[model samples]
Target: MTHPICRACGTQYAEPRDDCPVCLDERQYVAPGGQRWTSLKELQAEGHSGRFEEQGPDVFGIGVTPEFSIGQRALLLRTPAGNVLWDCVPYLDDEMVRRVEELGGIDHIAISHPHFYSVMVEWAHAFDAPVHLHEADREWVGRPDPALQFWSGRTKPLTDELTLINPGVHFPGSTVLHSSAGDGALFTGDVVNVGPDPRWVSIMYSFPNHVPEQPQKVRAAADLLAGYRFERIYGAWWGRVVTSGGEEVLARSVERYLRFERGE
Candidate 1:
């Protein structure tokens, strides 16, 4: 009967498929059905019975590495221009790299596409840091070793308080990285996803079903995330979003996805 992964993101695709074809098809689903798997050491033994949550002040949410999907957690900020790892989790051992080198080893490791770019060269050589990725998804780097570092076009600072904004909109170099901390955050990994009315956020075109047949490039990726003022907004799992505001919830989710894709 084995088939229960993806309670949010422990990808294990090989056979016996039903959904989660890279995050639920038909433009992402899971309204009340969407979850299935059978192997990968049972989602890494359920992320070794996962546990870890801080919430604020350098936010942290660990849990979901085991079979991944139970709110898939990974967020630890200390931006003063250093220590940032937006999205990355396919499970990394060694006590999660010694609790992230006692909190300071990771200098940088950005990711908002390529399926969360899991493992990411083993979390960038276990914190020697440097795994940017965005050269147009780099063909969905499913382990394109060599410590990876693609980047190209539209902003990229990395220190002096971090920066790396693409705003292309959901893949195709869909990027977003702007965190000076506190009331200034924007690490949108799915181009933007944080709803359930945490203030507002909902704009998609293909969130796993391929819906960008060209609605003006999904409103030009929500007009490149409406310029940015991010008071908080980080999404990739769970209730989606680790924080809030995030420039009025990404400008009311791009005017409610441009009035539901012009069906106005």
Candidate 2:
């Protein structure tokens, strides 16, 4: 039996349902027509395929070619310890699996928040890797599996150079991965949105709904990340990378966001 996937978010459900709880939430929205579901087989038949592109040294971005739901690219971080897959996408194919296997495969799958929890269990099972998600947002998980592992607290170290930090701006468990490779890079999955401008990043509660995050929450998130040292910021999607001065961009963006919230 083919598992049903949410048309909006592309999260596979444990069983078929009339409505997707994730889309019905205020943070997300159901289509005007209604809730629609599609299976991965259907998506593949429709010509959706996953591909990987090298973004930096040992860092590759994997995403669907035709662009499936939410259209976020997953980052494959190759480290000396092992490979870490950050923020999964909707579609995974044989080619993707083969390519990943060629690149040493994934040891751990970490999601930044509930929104990016797309087909995580499928990916984990495929690679026999551990799936890590924030414990606070466990309710949003559509498909639970034995590979799923819940974590709490502000910071969790996945490896010597890579650490997951919860900034708590978009969601209670919204996270960013700090890597000590190269100069340093932060793999932020919409937690810190690299924007229309490369010099700034924004925090939002809901990007589709145009809901801005609270000023205090944004400040607190930034404060929490201030301890980290990273020169680049990689957002969830393609072309959303802040190439340099990521630390400065975040500081200025937070200040600007707060000022606007205060009507200054």
Candidate 3:
């Protein structure tokens, strides 16, 4: 009686379905062969394991060993209040649970958007932590649970130092975690992509489907983020971090995107 998980996006469902609504949407695409499904047990049996690596003084990146669905790394922000789990992965095992517990268990779990909402309910239940998700994207939730908490507004503060900022770029509820730790860092889960240049980040409506966001939407997202002071920006993947000057980089990137969109 294992819940079915989408192989492409890693979203768990209350029951088995022919296709994952998230993947079938315009933002994402089903595989060429069609929709596929897998279970956590099946993934674990195939040798998928989760591991955490220190990215900064109190920030760690948690990801699967063999790279599970979507292949996005979850960020662990450790603070005096407690640890916050940002985003999630598909596969979770005893080893990963024990390791996270050793690091002082997750106090809260927050997802940036529906695309990164992979097995979040399971994670919350494991740590007895509350899951925070934006109300705008509540329909995208696959597995409903009592631990899920839906929020609205442009920003929601988790702790005095950490806040969830919704820029509304990729999705209506696209969110990023802003932390005052380590000269200020933004944990953006593909809402603001850390471009290859490392000095800039780009916003997109869809990464997989090659959909671009409107110029005004991009500008608005940037303007919303301008209110915050962040020195570094961390994206969902490994090695996708802007080491410094995140604010300037984001502004420049927005301008660049707008310029290109206008054929300037």
lDDT of 1 at 214: 59
Candidate 1 C-alpha lDDT tens digits along 105-214: 67878877656665566567778788888897675453456678887987788776668877666666777787665577776756666756667765565655646535
TM-scores across all candidates? 0.33, 0.98, 0.98
lDDT of 1 at 254: 70
Write one digit per residue (lDDT tens) for candidate 2, span 145-247.
Answer: 8899999999999999999998888888888899988789999989899987889898999988999998888888999899988999999888889989999
At residue 103, give the lDDT of candidate 2.
Answer: 95
When summed lDDT is taken over every stretch of 10 residues in candidate 1, the lowest stretch is 1-10
Relative to the true structure, how large is the alpha-carbon lDDT of every model?
0.63, 0.90, 0.90
Stretches of candidate 2 exceeding 4 Å from the true structure: none
Name the TM-score of candidate 3: 0.98
lDDT of 1 at 240: 64
Candidate 2 collision pairs:
none
- Tens digit per residue, CA lDDT, model 3, 176-198: 99998668988898999987789
Screening candidate 3 with a backbone cut-off below 3 angstroms (N, C-alpha, C), the clashing residue pairs are: none
Angstrom error of the Cα, residue 241, model 1: value is 24
